[model samples]
Each structure stands twice: as C-alpha cells, then as structure tokens.
Target: MPLPHRVSDLSAFDLLLSVAELGSIGAAARAHAITQPTASARLSGLERGLGIALLDRTARGSRLTRDGALVADWARTAVGAAAALDVGITSLRRTRESRVPVAASLTVAEYLLPHWLAALRPSAEGASVALTTGNSDDVAAAVLAGEARLGFVEGPDVPAGLTAATVGRDTLTVIVRPGHRWARRRSGITADELAATALVSRERGSGTRRALERALRRGTDRPLEEPLLELSSTTAIKAAVAEGVGPAVLSSLAVAAELAAGTLIRVPVVALDLTRELRVVHPAGQALTGTPRTLAAIARRSASLDDPAG
Candidate 1:
C-alpha cells in the first residue's frame, strides 16, 4: 500500500510559509526566484500531502487557514534551525577567513547593503562577511550583543553605543496595483481618502511604519485607522498590495520592479514628502575606518538603488 501522506518537504513548506506571509502564489514564487505555476504545483502537492487545505483564497488574495498559520509558524522554526545547522557547518570548515559580521535592518539589506558588499569584495583583504538582517531595533541588539560589528538603520534615532552617519536617502511612495482605483491617475490624493480605505502596511517598530505614520499625520487626523493588513517584511507588504489586498505606502527604492513593470502604480500626495535618510552606524569612539571602511566604500560603488536600471 502507498503512504497515506508523505512527510513535508522543504520546498513545499517554504512555499506554504512564503504564501502565508506573502498572500499570493505568484508573489510567493517570485520571493524564492521561482515561477507562479511551479509554486502553485508545489503548494497543491503539499495540500495533498497533508490531506487538508492550507490557504483560504479569495478575489483579494490568499490567507492562511488557522491550521495553515500555525503550521507555517512551526515550519519557519524548523527552517531557521536548518539554517543554523548550515551556519555551524561553515564555522567548522577551519578556514582562515576574517569573521567580520554585519547586521543591517531590512530596508538597508533589501535595497542598499548588498550592492555595497558586492562592490566591496575587491578590498576585503580575503576577509569573509556574514550578513544578518533584522528590524532596526533588532539590528541594534545584534550589534550590542557583539554578534555584528556594524549596523545600518534608516531612521533618525541612534542606538546606544553607536555613532551614525547619513549615507543616502529613500523616498516613500504610496503604492497600489495597476488595477487599484488610485493608480488610475498621477494627481495628488487627499489624506481623508486614504483614511477611509483599507491600508496594508508594516508592523510596529518598523522604520517604514514610523516614517509613514509621521507623514500621514502631517495631513490627516490624529492616530489614523488601523491597517487592514500588517506585516513585518517589505517584500511581504509588497506582495499583499500586488494581490489587491489594499493600497500601501512603501519606499520608492524598494518597489523599482513593480513600478517599471506597471504591476504597481505610484500615487502622488501633495506637500506630503515621505523621504528618510539611510544611515550607517557602528560602535561609538571607534573609527570604522578599516576593513569596514573598505566595505562601505564598496557599498557606495555598487549601490544599485542609485541606479535601478543596472
């Protein structure tokens, strides 16, 4: 007799988890660098393996069934453990590489630092860089705990034991899918309109969320309505918006592809500039003028956000 159900595989699990965070099959596949049909197939197979439905699909997008949400959280824990194992293996390689670890908040990690690190490779003096990504608060904690030597944050506040320097700026854009009503034109919209609708956004303590709240309050009433969907990752927020979950405010630097492909439309807000400076911060009284210096140099050289076409 054949098996009643196969044990969960990594791809299926990851896809399900991604879909749960991401809210759409196409968006989930894109997150993992796969195609939509392939993601759909993997998810379907996983549903069969479990003999239960995982997603609650609708015209708006996908949501996890209560069971799926619980399973996704469990799967994420398992995947994180697997990653820790891989990291442990790398540590046992007995290599002579330098152990300089860099922690960056999600915005910097997704938009800026990768380019900087790529260009910085030539000057690394054979040192290897280990990157850890988290929220601004979490990145600061990582650095304070000695897990990373440097951090990048986008907001104005400075962490204790850290000195910050302005590196660049990222402007936030109110965005929605091409099919969204606001995307029909380029004229500025009123804050009252936004306050009346469903808003999908990042969760608390996110630099983007803080910045957005400040910007919104500049024109709207005090303490706007709660978000329709609140997520932790920029990519996840984008996915939700793409599936017509609701309109969102996001960094222009983060949505280059969607803007270029016409998948997302940028709406205008008059006198409502939503720009924030990106900063590099590290331990105070310490000159980051060494290998980190070279890394920063490389980051500036390869900063892809400056030139999105490349």
Candidate 2:
C-alpha cells in the first residue's frame, strides 16, 4: 500500500506531534530548534498536502482541531518509531556501551534525575543514560509501551498497567510573588479558599495539577475553579507567579531556589496534605534487571539519604 504523501516527510509529522505536546506552533518550533515561521510553513504544507485543516489558531495558542487530534495520534506512532531508530543508530555508532533510556516526569527530569544519574555513574563504572522528559502520564505510557526501560512519576496514584514502588516523596508548595497577599497572611489558606481562587497552574494531566486538584476536592464534591493561566512548562508557571500573575502550586523541589532567594514566597495551605510519592515504575510483571535495576537502586539510595529515618 502507498503511504500518504503528506507524511512522507517525517520531520513534518514530528512538528505536528510537537504542536500537540506543546500546545503552540511557536513553542513546538522552539523545541524543534526551528523558527516559528518555519514551523508555521511546515504545518501549513502538511495541512495542504493532507487536504485537511489540522490546527485551530487562536490568540492564546494553537490547538489540534478534531481531525488534527486524530492526525497527531497517528503521528505519535511514527515519531516513536523514528525515535527508536535514532536511538538504535546512535547506539550502533558508539564505541562504548549503550546507555539506558529512562522516561521521567518533568519534575524528576529537571531537578532529581541529574543527581541520581551522577550518583549512578561512578558506581556503575561510568554508566551512560538517555533521559526523556514528559508529564507523569506520558512517562508512565512510555514505560508501558516499552519506549523506556524505566520511568519515574510524581502523581498521587500510580498509573494502571505498570508495577511501581515508592522511591521518594515530595510535597507541593503553594507559591506567590513576594508582594502577594498570601505571602503576608499569618494563617495558612484553607482548601475552600484555594478552590475559590483562579490561580496559575500546570496543564491538565500533569501530576502537579492533579495533586493540587485532589487536595482541593477532598471532603467536598465541588469542582475546581479554572486556572488564571494554564501553562505546560513549570518554568513558565514560575515566571508567571514571580510576576504576581497569581498563586501557583508547584513541586517543592522546583521552588526551593526561588524560595531561598525570596523571589517567590511559600503560602501554606491549611488542612491540605499536598505530599505525593515519587515512584519508579516499569511494565507489570516484568522483573527488574540490568541497568534498570541498577538505576532503581541508586534512586532508592538517594531517597534514603534525603530522609533522616533511613
């Protein structure tokens, strides 16, 4: 069977996947190390060649239209295959041993994995690693799909179909600009108060956002209030909160530096247990071995070192 001419260029399919992931052509372009105009042109060309509109552009950002969503889903398979090929080719070209590929949540990838990797390297005689970053849900999916040998996630609940063990714990800290009213309050804000406010938030499906919503919805059936701004990146959220756009809940690991520098102040939430487990997960019923087992041991050791009880 002849393949569609529109997808003959794998890079164009990659850009569409990036657009779906990043929620904007500009952001996707930046991620791909291309100009916005280039990304726009590629997307336009893809749509024209496919004879279907794939994206709906708005002032806020671009989103997949109905047909676009289906295309993006199909594109994901192609991109995944390409990624596997890239990894394989790189491994073949390398003289040294192949690196273990791990998928991790943004919080873990940004703040924790580097330290763990460093700790693992010397002990494993200079082991190498390839890390992929995504939301917890995405990370879980990667592990389950065999795209990664291991995965780390920070959500309140473990994703189904993956076997998981709690490797560590982290708390969600509510942060606001120094000048925000919450920073000056003597009392911590209540769950009810938090639910009533429209604040900066991670995008839906993010573990950080899910943990926050779970805390807010406890003891009541009320729905969460819409966010003042929904950003896919934690860096964006921090920048928005630092500018006093609104209060936001983020991983304490993510905000420690900002808190110490006084650029962002922590606002305690009364009656909220925002603590969540950091988990290491792999495919269900699969026994850990090789690099995956080694990495997991290092992670657990690091977790123990951070905890006084260990």
Candidate 3:
C-alpha cells in the first residue's frame, strides 16, 4: 500500500519530535547534525503535508504550537518504533554475516579446507563455519538445493544451476603397491593400457573417479573396463592399493604421505592429462556476500599457494 503523504517522511517527523523535546529549532538542528535553516525548511514541509500549523516562531526562538505538541507526542511512538526496527535488522544482518555453511568434495574437505579455514579465522572475526563433506555431485546438489551457502567441487563440470570459479588445480595419480608389476616399470603405461586394467577405484560420483574417466575418454576409444573393486573413500582406496589389491587413480594430495613413506609407488600415465580444477561454486544468479565471499577469497589465496602456477 502507498504511504500517506502526511507521514511519508519519517526523518521530518523525527526532526519535529526533536524540536519539541529541545524547545528550539537551532538546538534540534544541532542534535540532528543539520543546519538550522535546513531543519526549519524540513519542519515547514512536514507542517504543510500534515495541513497543521506545527510551530510558533518568535524573535527569541521556535516552539511547538498546541497542535504541534499533539503531533509530536504521536510522532514519538513512530520514531521509537523505527529505532527499534533498525536495531532488529542490524542484529539479523550480523547473525547472517557471522555464520557460513559450506559444502565440499571429500578430497578438498580432507586435505585443503582445514588450512583454508584456519586462515579464514583471523579475518572472519567470530564467524563460524559449518562444513559438509561429500562427493562433487553431492556438493553441487547441496548448493542447488540451498542446503549450503557455498560449495567447493573437484570435478571438471559445474552443475547447471551453479556458478563456479577455478580456485586451484589438482592432478590425479596412478598409484600401486611396490610389489605390483606396474610399480617396476621405469616408463609409464599408455592410456589404453591403463583403461583396460581393472583397478580399485572410488564410487561412481567421486570427483577423482570422474576426473580419471574424463581423461581416459579423451585418450582412448576403447570401452573403459569396470573397476576391480569400488571403494567410497580415498583412504580406503589407498589402503587397498597398499595391500596389493590393484592400481588406483587418486589425487596427488591424497597419496603424498604414503609416497613419501615408500608405501605406495606413482606410475605415470603417458599422454593423458590427469589434472582437474578445484572450484568454488554458488547459485548462479545470487552474488556471494558476507562470510561466504570472504571464505572464498581465502580459499583461492590458500589454494594458489598450494599450486604456484595457478
């Protein structure tokens, strides 16, 4: 509904109340940090809108007339209520800015997010982060469904309803137990050879699995063989590979420790690009703001340090 003209300018009403309380136009103007003439003009406009003589101007100063006093009393309620409303809105905004909900694929959650969040703490003030870990597909779904305000994904493709920015890069590694025959090869295997072999692999929706499949599809026309075994977590895949279950494709970030410890061997794949982008995603039409935006910036900076080339 349209506001009535008489009460439309709340600032004018506030000035009127101030004038009534202070008993002079100059004092009211000083209290509101406005010049006397400006305050007088605003009150004049308000009186005209309300169709009432609101002030009695004299040589010494200005004072509220009988009608003006009645209006001032009524205006006080509105002005006080508006003040209360402003406080409430500010509180709500602060609460929203201090809480951030994020979804991330397993690899990023396990390896990257802890550091990123740690860096976020200083700038975030008292803001708290609620993290959800899942496969890339699940992260995308959470963002689309409004279950998470921001999402990090390791897969190559962004979901249709989300906007994404590449925050970093990760390379998939072909790892095997030291006793496996592929571990002994001084030279890497071809894409066709890798695709034909059944290896312990992540579940279908995992970003690591998706990245490997995307790379192989580009390099080979041969139908990709099924995994010898499907495991859900990178830790499980690493454990299986360590026990000589078979070779598995994993993110280099995931197998760094085992490789350093000589428990796992990295087998290079020839002419196949195993690198995939790490991305931060949000709903397509909405702009990221508050804590989410700050966290994304932190994530990008931190990830860049992880890959100096990014």
Please name the candidate that would achieve the greatest lDDT relative to the true structure: 3
TM-score of 2: 0.66
| Per-residue lDDT of 167 in model 1 | 75
Off by over 4 Å in 1: 1-97, 195-197, 300-310
Model 3: how large is the Cα RMSD against the reference?
2.6
Candidate 2 residue runs with Cα over 4 Å from true position: 1-97, 219-221, 304-310
Q: Which stretches of candidate 3 lie over 4 Å from their true place?
A: 1-5, 35-37, 304-310
Number of backbone-clashing residue pairs for each candidate, in the order shown: 1, 0, 0
State the number of backbone clashes in model 1: 1
Pairs that collide, model 1: 116-299
Poorest stretch of ten by lDDT in candidate 3: 301-310
How does residue 59 of candidate 1 score in lDDT? 79
Local lDDT at 215 for model 2 = 76
How close to the true structure is residue 111 of candidate 2, measured as C-alpha lDDT?
86
Give lDDT tens digits, candidate 2, residues 194-233.
Answer: 8888989988778889888887777346667899999989
lDDT tens per residue, model 3, 1-310: 9988779789998998888788889999999999999999999898888899999999888888999999989989989999999999999988877878899999899989999998888888989998999999999999999989999999888879999998988888899999999888879899999999998999988888898899999999988999999998999999999988899998888888888888999888889888889999999999998789988998888784242111
Task: Compute each candidate's TM-score over C-alphas.
Answer: 0.63, 0.66, 0.90
